[model samples]
Target: MKKYLPLIIAILLLALAYLTGYSKYIGLAWYGKATLIGGAGGIILTLGAYWFDKNRLNITLIALFAITTAVTYYYARIFIDSADFEPTAGFVWYIGYHIGVALFIPTVAYILQKILPQSASIE
Candidate 1:
């Protein structure tokens, strides 16, 4: 159970991120969109690669970031037109910014996991 906790938390956070995006209440729909598609892509890629490769996690994370950035930009046109919000940057720049943020999750998680001390047992 302890070994799987981090995975479970990551999954839950992904879900929560999507829900928040779908809700569109916090004005961060781009994040929600990115997480939704990226996470789905990640899951699919992870499962598909699991049998052939030992680096499924890394592959999934990379795919998630790439897909999320692409999808978010693809969908952003519709969102921007439908909503009244204005973007400060061009579409390419906006997408790049979001991608940077989206990719931060895995990078930060990796760093934290490496820097933090592990517990001998989880209660």
Candidate 2:
């Protein structure tokens, strides 16, 4: 049960963000702040997952990325005007964004894990 905590927390966060209409605020200040918070949360949760199970880091990160992308896309489609939403271009950008976050958050978390004292445990 403990091993699944990070993924659970991530799913909850994704659900909260989705239900709250978070993506509807894109291009606004609150959306930027939300992105930062979400990014930090992702790093923390991914790090926790990594600590709990070193072997499953990649899968955990991928799952988190997929959740984020799905939620973002879902809300974007509803709120954004179809005239401005190019399916191909938007999807390509979304993929790029996911790749960037999926790679960056874990790398930063790994570095922070190494830098911080071993006594500091996320669990």
Which candidate ranks first by lDDT, i.e. highest? 2
TM-score of each: 0.37, 0.38
Clashing residue pairs in all predictions, respectively, total 0, 0
Backbone clash pairs for candidate 2 read: none
What is the per-residue lDDT of model 2 for residues 1-123, given as tens digits with 9 covering 90 to 100?
443344445455544555676644432123444455555566676767666775456566677668768867775665475565567556645544544434445544444444555444234
lDDT by residue for model 1 (4-65), tens: 33334545655675565642553335555554564554344434544445334466567766
Instruction: Identify the runs in model 1 with alpha carbons over 4 angstroms from their true place.
Output: 1-8, 20-31, 59-89, 93-123
Q: What C-alpha root-mean-square deviation, in Å, does candidate 2 show against the real structure?
A: 9.6
Q: State the weakest 10-residue window (summed lDDT) of model 1.
A: 114-123
Superposed Cα deviation of residue 85, candidate 2 (Å): 10
